[model samples]
Target: MDLTVLSYVIYLFISIVLTVWVARTLSRAGRVFLAQVFPGSEHLAEAVNHLLVVGFYLVNLGFVSLYLKSGATTETARQVFEGLSVKEGVVLLVLGGMHLGNVFVLNKLRSNSRRDFAVIPPIPPTGFLPEVEA
Candidate 1:
């Protein structure tokens, strides 16, 4: 196979592998975050974690497939390495970006949930009333 074809093959393999690894890592940790976000709802956390993993796979794999096109010919070993580096680097950035976005959104949900449950009386009782015989 020519160097260009070789680079495509290598890029696809690395991109797919990296995406899978990141998805798994996020799924594992996301459960905990989701649990905190939806406190006292283990099932909800697990379900949300599963949905997030599915969405992550779809978005990232779609990006990889769309980005598989080579920008220039990879006729030499150096070209193959360079092409792979750039392609892999972009994939990594996309993965990191997705992770951060998920975290930001979940944190918002967490904070909102906490606010809903928080209870702070506007003012303390001026005085306690004397107990009367029932």
Candidate 2:
């Protein structure tokens, strides 16, 4: 196999693996945050975590599979170094960036959930008032 093909394959593999790993980690940590977000329903929070991971994988993998590889060619050290084309690089960068962004957004959501549900003061119960005789 050619080096370029190998490189592309490695890149794709690593990108997918990284994305999935991050997604799973976020989902696991998200349970706590999700609890905060939804407050009263642990089941709902767990479901949301699962759904987020599923959606994240579906979107990211679809994009990665559809990504176009750069043209293959031979070149000297300088050419090879300078040969990093804008299109391919941009696509890979975007892929990585999207994964990173997903993690960031999910983390923020989790934190917000936690903050939104921290704690509350207890409510006081009122006894019945005495009725006046007519």
Candidate 3:
């Protein structure tokens, strides 16, 4: 097999395995955070978590497929390793970015939810004011 082909195979395998592992880890751990953000809606949190995982897979896999092609042809073992490293690095970076983006958006949602549930002082009714003769 050509070095380039081997690199591509290894890259795809590693990238896919990493993606699945990360996705599962996030989904499992993020449920608590999602539940907190949703507040009294564990079902909704789970649903959202599932949807997020699906979307994550779609986007990341699409990126992986699109990025499969290497600019330079690999002939040597060193070149194969180098190519794999670069490709894997990009995949890792993309995964990290996606994870961060998800966390940022979820944090915003949690913050907003907290704000929505914040306590507010009640105002006195206008009609409760005593009338004074002029």
Candidate 4:
């Protein structure tokens, strides 16, 4: 096969792998954040993590399938960059921006969760209430 074909294949593979890996990492981190925010609800953290990963894969893989290119050229950086269409560049930039925003949001969520956990007290039993009747 030609070098373009090889490069395209490599790029696709790397992009998919990186996106999925980042998604999974974000899921786990989000779980930690949720654990802090929810106090006694650690199970919710795991559930949210799985749900986020599912959504990430669905959206990103859809983009990958739609935007993939098959051929490439061995040329200077300027030539290679110039060959890209405006639409393609915009799509890629949007995807990258989305990923960065996802990370930022997750980090903020984690920080807020830590703060919430720190301020809350443990739950008390319902029966622990004092008897008011004579």
lDDT of 3 by residue, 11-129 (tens): 99999999999899889878877888888888899999999999999999999999999899888999999888888999999999999988887788888888888979898677766
Worst 10 residues of 3 by lDDT: 121-130
lDDT winner between 1 and 4, please give it.
1
Model 3 earns a TM-score of 0.88
lDDT of each: 0.90, 0.67, 0.90, 0.65
Estimate TM-scores for all models.
0.86, 0.58, 0.88, 0.56
Residues 26-94, candidate 2: write the lDDT tens digits: 677767767767778888888988887888788777766766355656344443334434434655576
Q: What's the distance in Å from true for residue 15, model 3?
A: 0.4
Root-mean-square deviation of candidate 1 = 5.7
Error of 3 at 87 (Å): 0.7
lDDT of 1: 0.90
Q: Kindly indicate the candidate among 2 and 4 with the higher lDDT.
A: 2
Ranking by TM-score: 3, 1, 2, 4
Candidate 2 off by > 4 Å: 72-134
